[model samples]
Target: MKLGISSASVTERYGYDKGFELIKKSGFDAVDVGLEQYGVESDPFKLYHRSEDEFCTFFDTIRKLAEKWELEISQTHGRCNTYSMDKEHNAYVRWVSERDLKATSLLGAPACVIHAIVSGRFPEHYQNLEFMISKNAEMYGDLAPFAEKNNVKIAIETSGRAMVNGREIKGCFSDAPVFQKMFEAVDTRCKTVCVDTGHTNEAVPFGAPKVQELIRLLGKEITILHLHDNNGTYDQHLPPIRPSRGTVEWCEVFETLDEIGYSGVYNFELNLIQFGGVMDEAVRFLGKYLRYFIENKGKLM
Candidate 1:
């Protein structure tokens, strides 16, 4: 797999230009442009409303810089939900989601990562798993045409089922079975899965499949990745922890990807530079390591 990093790694530190430049200098092959910088949800839509011309210019600038650095924008991420009950808010979120797809196209990325959008806090809403799956399919079906038009695919991400206010509630498509059903419901040509390692760690104890197992289960349907580490509780988004530093079994993860013939990018979604190290060396090390892992499949780290 090609090694890449998210632009979000340095957005707060250097803004877009310098941030992207740093990613390139660090030897990453691609980037994940996080449109959430504009705003998390309805805010991106609001930003565009405030100045459509400026919004377009911002992405234009990003594309030019990525070209300058020879870095590909492999994927993009922003917030959108299909299960919300509020009609007006849902409409606004949908608008932002479309803009995210357009932004992915603008950057020449092939996919855009999205959440399944069901909150664990609301048990009443998700009593029927079929309903939740159908909602996701319906929403992605609406988005697929635009995705195809933009030459992009919707990468549904696996997230953690959370405990809200002492209630153990299920998250949207947090498990392999539900995700498989959802995938079957949607137009597969325009959609795929982007597994978040950290989130997967959190989901395992809740009956969700292990990271490698999920990879083995989904196989080619898993087209993208969001690499990071967490402490087995929340989505910490920490830099890749030492193999012994966390719950994830890195060697097994690589083994499964190899077994399934994953030919995609090993895109790190963590804080690449701020975690205290030489940026270039850090990136080069990660790239080299991933290459080694791919070359030596099933060999334990």
Candidate 2:
């Protein structure tokens, strides 16, 4: 249960080298290479523009930098455009995902988290969900071999409701039962789940399962995490500590992780806005607080 964080926010502010330095200075043991899949993108990530060799070389360099600091390249987020409505862009997303698998392998990371498409092609949420699931099965089933060949398992992250067309919509893979269905639908060991704590919390208002119950349902199926906090409605991505940080059922999360023997990284995906501008020191403080409870086996919780 090592402390880790996504490099997206830090890298956006500091670039890769300095961002890696800040991460090391923040007392983290591992990191998730954000392939710039987060946020709305008008175009693909700059890394995706590089030639194949350059992409591989870039990740290799990033991996070496992590090694230089004694930090592990634990996982990566694949480039996925969850908000884009253009079906054509889906083709590019799939292409970049394969490249990401290769880069993830080069980085020595075991998994890559790719988001399912939010196909808002239908009026009802259920209809859109079914379409997304089919698309996921098709896409993942096609890429399963590549994932295995690259030694990078693709993690299907739990989805959250986000604003689209001025209305909130719950997308596919929004809950544990949907996860089970997707697994049944796609027969591949190359795929797994990366449960986002904030997303699951965000679903509570719509009668989704509690975080602990979802943990119990998913159990060992979970191989990674996108740990963060939200206000149980909006996707705030706040630090997972107190001060009404909406890390709901915090004790149950750790307790259930122990029960399931989860050894994966406790990775944070903070948006870096709610900390009152402490910046790097704030990241360090949040990591320290999380480790305190984890190391104490929730006795301190």
Q: Which number leads on TM-score?
A: 2
Residues 150-235, candidate 1, lDDT per residue (tens digit)? 88899998867665556664465777777788888886587888988888887777777888887788888888999777777677
Alpha-carbon local distance difference test for all models: 0.74, 0.75
Output the TM-score of candidate 1: 0.86
User: TM-score for all predictions?
Assistant: 0.86, 0.88
User: Residue 117 in model 2: shift from native, Å?
Assistant: 2.7
Off by over 4 Å in 2: 37-45, 82-87, 119-125, 128-131, 162-166, 169-172, 245-247, 273-277, 296-301
lDDT of 2 by residue, 143-182 (tens): 7899988878988788777555567755545667886787
Residue 69 displacement in candidate 2 (angstroms): 0.3
